[model samples]
Target chain A: MDEDAKAVATALARESAADGLRRLTDLLLRVADDDPGLAAIAQELDRITEELDQITEELDQITEELDRITEELGASDDGRRPVGVDPVAGRANACAPPLEVWCLPDGTAGASGSLGITYQGPRGLVHGGVSALILDHVLNVALSEQGPAAAGGELSVRYHRPLPLYRNFLATGRLSRGADGELRAVGEITVAGVVAVSAARIVGGRGVRM
Target chain B: MDEDAKAVATALARESAADGLRRLTDLLLRVADDDPGLAAIAQELDRITEELDQITEELDQITEELDRITEELGASDDGRRPVGVDPVAGRANACAPPLEVWCLPDGTAGASGSLGITYQGPRGLVHGGVSALILDHVLNVALSEQGPAAAGGELSVRYHRPLPLYRNFLATGRLSRGADGELRAVGEITVAGVVAVSAARIVGGRGVRM
Candidate 1:
């Protein structure tokens, strides 16, 4: 397979693994008992841990092999932007929910995703910090699409209502060039057509004032 | 084992699983190459996926067994507050970095943690959102320690400098009860005695207006 195809395959495999881990995490958090079955469940957990250790060893070897290959490939080290993968939006990142983004014609961006129990924070509600993460990513994407590359400077979030877990949410962000030449962006996350979280961000770039 | 012991064991096991997943994710994202070794890495990934599938099936059965036990135990269904486990700061949550929090004598909360590559964003820096997450959790913990249970209303973060990944950072938060009875929180994330991110949050509880 070609390099691009291999990259895609690797991302897909990693995403699948992330999905399995997410499920396992959800189960582990919600699973509880005081019955006699507790002993059996604990035993099963022990077995799972043993299996996970074995997998960890195998993964370590794979990582070493891949590192050797990367060295042979002589990849560039810019150290500013990731070469091909975004740790926040990358499919390989199990911590990030699968969000889809689209750039609108009017210098704004739209995003949509269904968050599950794995993102739960306050009981059945989505973790407030996770919402911030999504908004930060979406706003940055919108800013980049409209202007030069920049780094986030200030971000503020308002929680209008509790975002429920296991529901679809829509996020939209718009970018505007501030009078000071800073990139200003606004993002909103809505659940069931109701605004749950709103964010405003200011970003600094090459020609922008701090 | 008793129920409490079982719970602790389960949490530990889940944490181990999360650690393994985090390592696997970091390796996957950092893995790349254009060399002939790509083929071997891909095959190893395939094997990993198969093993993951088997693990998933086993976890599924375990989930069912645990569910039956929970039913027998007659756990309460508040649905708003998790009965036992906290998905955010729970030791079992792989998604949360290992954060240690302690209440200071001055009524403030101090947290310390070393974030890994799993939280990387913007090249070597910790993801902007992850910073928010850690700050939010820490601030809330401070507020709760000083005041009644409340929900976050507004959170504002200022990024003074990039928080580097895989570095130990100190976070501190203090709560002040406003005249309106709202809980106000201020938090700062510092790296090597330099403040990287500062946050202010207002939380609402009984008698507090939105």
Candidate 2:
């Protein structure tokens, strides 16, 4: 199992043990007034309580480690905008993408984007629909270089992957081919560069802006 | 002007006239105590208000007539979906499309799609960005069908029309051509069958579900 899973499991075991000890203490207290072995039972109960204290400490350590792991996972896959580049073309200096995005230099009109808190979807995690919105934005903006134009005449995206909540992600869009008045663009949204969603669009001449 | 536009204009005029009368009433009230001579002026104001009322009533009647015209204009349109029907193969339903999609007896894709509330982009009217989203959705879906069966790959869409808000809209997607495991799609979004958004997509075979 993964480190996080292991930590979680350890924490659960320790907590359960602690709870069991507390239950034993409660049973001992309830019978102490009537049982002739009350004194012995009281001694055993003291030992169990001491053990529960140790278990509680161990569980606390595991919970802290699990929190760190969760943060690391979230940062690695959260998809909003990219890092080290301007989120907007000319306004990069003025507006950084709410998330981080990476601009690829492969001449394929490629860009990777990341998202963060301002773009929350689910209560604590990103919403699935918001993930699609981010993909659409990344793909549409990535095609801005084809002819100094930015807009979508058509777009189609499918949820091939489940976008998680509050996680770092990656989104990439590329211009595939172009001819006459038509151009083709494609993109993918990923978690830590793993494809979570795939999409495509057909764009034509600079028509009236919608 | 189109019927919808005309209706809008007439309604605006009537609203303006009513507002004018109300303003005049306030003006006369303010002047009543300041100058006895203003009583004469109030008579003139009354006459002007009566004239405005007449114009307002006439415009209201015209607006009602125009409303019918606008409804008719919005109801019928020339947009269709094209799916080749194979009578013996039971593939005729393939040609059926989303509601409001126009179709010819022949299986050729139409050039327009109607706009609806789901396409809203802004607060009240259809948002330009949302309009683009709709166009993209249609083109990408159409391209998916025309491209390789396993070609459910990445795609992109471009917006070429200003899809107006609060008006009946039409949209279309056309498969221009496909080659080398790559395919091209093109189409336009229209308002009342008038072009509002244009799009294109380049698709390939990879992650396509269909």
Q: Against the true two-chain complex, what DockQ does each candidate achieve?
A: 0.35, 0.04
Evaluated at residue B51, the lDDT of candidate 2 is 42
Candidate 2's residue-wise lDDT over A1-210, tens digit each?
554553344334322322222222222112212233323344443443344334334434433443443343343222222111121221111112234444456534333445432222222333333444455556555676655644435565655545664466666778776444456667776778677777665555442222
Q: What TM-score, to 2 decimals, does candidate 1 have?
A: 0.78
- Point out where model 1 deviates above 4 Å: A1-5, A33-87, A176-183, A204-210, B1-5, B33-88, B176-183, B204-210
Q: Candidate 1's residue-wise lDDT over B144-168, tens digit each? A: 7765644747777788899987789
Clashes (N, CA, C under 3 Å) per candidate: 0, 64
Docking class of 1: acceptable
Q: Give the worst 10-residue stretch by lDDT in candidate 1 chain A.
A: A76-85
Deviation from native of the Cα of residue B184 in model 1, angstroms: 1.7
Give the per-residue lDDT of model 1 (tens digit) for A55-131.
55665665565556456545422222223345457655666676776777777877798876667776678878788
Query: What's each prediction's TM-score?
Result: 0.78, 0.31
